[model samples]
Target chain A: MTTGAYPSQSTARLTRERFRAGECRPTAGIAPGMTQTNLIALPRDWAWDFLLYAQRNPQACPVLEVTDPGDWHTGLAEGADLRTDLPRYRVWRDGVLAEEINDASACWEVHPDLVTFLIGCSFTFENALLEAGIEVRHITDNTNVPMYRTHLPCHPAGRLQGEVVVSMRPLPAAHIARASTITARYPGVHGAPIHVGDPKALGIVDLDRPDFGDPVRIEPGEIPVFWACGVTPQVAVMASNVPFALTHAPGHMFITDVPDSRYHV
Target chain B: MTTGAYPSQSTARLTRERFRAGECRPTAGIAPGMTQTNLIALPRDWAWDFLLYAQRNPQACPVLEVTDPGDWHTGLAEGADLRTDLPRYRVWRDGVLAEEINDASACWEVHPDLVTFLIGCSFTFENALLEAGIEVRHITDNTNVPMYRTHLPCHPAGRLQGEVVVSMRPLPAAHIARASTITARYPGVHGAPIHVGDPKALGIVDLDRPDFGDPVRIEPGEIPVFWACGVTPQVAVMASNVPFALTHAPGHMFITDVPDSRYHV
Candidate 1:
């Protein structure tokens, strides 16, 4: 999906070139500052349910926009073309695992329509926290925000329903409060801590080993603050077991033209 | 639902008491220091569409919290009961005015299956504007903010769709800019101006004749700044012609515990 001509590679150009060359993988942290979104290329039949899914599960699915079918450019975010701008895409078949692909054109269909969802990513507020002199444990440890599947069920939208997934961060009590307050302002980025203390309360049994991502050390007085993770859509996608679906692998996010600051609640 | 309480009585208490007393009237001037919310209550059947609608049309529908069905306490705001708190409710059936009621208890069904939307109001920012020494035209004139139906189509949400409605205020260019920059920080209150200068650009034919609210004077050298208004939900709710719906009257709003300052984007 990223292949393109690079007359002169700039930050955006080089980044696009890398994606175009297939040199960039799903997890590449190539660019920063710009907003990153979640991708959901589903059949036209399922687009409505998926959109409802995002709306019902806002913390995990704070949608930036849904592009007009097959029209990939997100005018909200610097006219970035969703089809080719993204590093990669996945094809899901009726809730079943399907072949992973780089472009949709090969598998694109008018009836099995695809919708693009731009979700709020923590990367925006993670930057805000770091700039605010607050430490981001995940970045400090060079690990993904430890995500755990929770007992908290997402509000259902047709067949797209599943348990809420959350990412946890450990911080001192004061910083936890500060982070909660600072982050809550950006509703675009999951807005505040859903749970601030015991992981077991959210039904997770262990902190050292998460369902996804590496766990960081929790210092003496630090407590955990959990936020709804973007992985929620994948959970919903999986729960639906639709014949087809698409999502970015793990940390691979769809970069958007919207500035991180634009997501304030 | 207005039963068990004195209608129109001050309730000899605070916002909650007055509201609980079937004072479901204009919340515009109640609870001065407290935050007031705009309401959009829809049946659960249409929940996803309206939720998606709010998400797509944030400048106009910046959600404070989309409540979990049957459970009304926002847990974020003043923790007022969703079903009983607002002094009044307007029921829209099949896209037409059906009836105005004091409480939605008669309309309430368990699962009662419904979705409630809380939106930030201009009042929060108006206080800030007043404190900054800027004269709020509507407040000075003792009238609703001049609102008009714009040519802009609100990003559609299923069948739930309509044109964008903008509230306008005529102020000096410097004040308008400062107001934009200031309100730009408060995305909760419809954020900054969507358009400035020629109202026609937004498909507004006459600034003196508004679709809703009293028109304010536009002095020489003053420009009209238009912002996405909370009235948007009313337009969508009506335009969509959903089987059932509810919303607050113009200016009247639900007071919340959230401080206006907390909404700084």
Candidate 2:
């Protein structure tokens, strides 16, 4: 969140400083090595089914740390505060965008009952992939990873239901297997590639177009490897249209105390 | 389920037969090489919170599969009749013990009903650990694994509340690292050892005294390695005593079609 002097603030230190100061912004590359999680805050009534849906779909909706209902901060992620820790949060009420806020501390009063769900994001694995000589197209190209709505239906739990969302990476076929083996180690974060070759197999009709995030190039000889995207639970939330919901923006992530490697299975 | 000629029927074939005959029995050693899951059935009203509890406590509760409310069978596990697959069922009414039944077909009714939760057991990983020359105490002692109620509390979901239950395995120091590395792969089942040495750290007063199952010896240099157990959920069920709850008896698992190796990470 620090402008030109960003290097002066470490990822963990900076995240805390920015979040505590109420400076809300996208935290994509804010913390280089620290694990950044996806935020999905739902009403107490809807928390269980959402949790079950995530359980049913681990490859996509890997949970990092979940808080007890009515508890704002879970002790798992160091001193990170769930209510105002993230840069920004989007509020969805009845499937409609209601308000975007720097923090939800004010909103918590409406329901002492709101539950927090911090899910593992692909960003954790993508950071790992980059360090291992793999060129993450979106990061290299300075755009969000291309995410699509797949035809594959998630095994429904209770009333929460939706299609699977996948983030694609165009890497060599050889790297697909290696990537699968590497990322699969971190089941806490969305681990491993769910689909390796075909986009259409996931009901994706076009390569250049995506349902979420920006599209990147698929260089020749590079096979498109798809990993379960964090957007999965969001889609379920939208479909359910519960009276109220809150999630971090597209690139913004909730920074955690956990290191990337430790999240491995 | 058949008293005569338990042989002549392969584990796979036998699973199908018992399922067809509406026989619900403990599926501990049945179906060699295949995975067996723990079942936790709750009312539609309590489904979400419990599912969330499972998500937060996956190591103690690996959700291998789940069924929508009112649905009895988990299509993932080859026509598994949740109502009558396991040999017996423990019914809980308002967090109190209602009764233990041989079959739940008579108890089951339409809508506002059963949500089957298939949790992973340690059987699959024990097979792998054994193959690797590690000693799984209960297996050697010819009895059920020693499970103890821990002082450590789980991240609760809604009305679902409880303590963490752990299964013990005594191993030498050298095997601890290898054991940790190997078992860490099966996140769908309880992953690696949550505790390597100190039992008191988990609020366990006496190693000889356990809340469930029998205790085994910790030879000189042989130490206890604990993995979160599925019994953790039952503790919550016992604490809440939600009316009309069902779960597999301790060690009596619900056999599944999925292979054990498939669950690695």
Per-residue alpha-carbon lDDT of candidate 2 for residues A115-205, written as tens digits (9 for 90 to 100): 8888888887777787788888877777777889998888777687888889888998778877888888887777878888988888999
Worst 10 residues of 2 chain B by lDDT: B1-10
Which candidate has the highest TM-score of all? 2
TM-score of chain B of each: 0.85, 0.87
Q: True-contact fraction for model 1?
A: 0.26
lDDT of 2 by residue, B1-265 (tens): 1223323135755675675466754454456566777788887777777877887677898777777767787754655577776766777777777787767776666334777788888776877887798877776766667789998998777787899999888899999999998888887788888998999999899989878767787899988889988888889998876766788777667776666767886
- Candidate 2 segments exceeding 4 Å error: A1-10, A16-26, A67-85, A93-113, A217-220, A237-244, B1-10, B13-28, B93-99, B109-112, B135-137, B172-174, B198-209, B217-221, B240-244
lDDT score for residue A25 of model 1: 53
Candidate 1 lDDT, A1-265, residue by residue in tens: 2223332213444565566556545432334445566677666667767776776567788888876556566655454555565676666666555775555565555433566677777766776777778787777766666788999999786667889888888888878777888888788878888998989889999998887667778889888889888878877777878766677655556765455656654
The sequence of per-residue lDDT tens digits that candidate 1 reaches over residues B117-232 is 88877766776777777788777767777889987988897778898888887888878878877777788778888988889899888888998767888789899988888888
Chain A TM-score by candidate, in order:
0.85, 0.88
Docking class of 1: acceptable
Interface RMSD of 1: 4.0
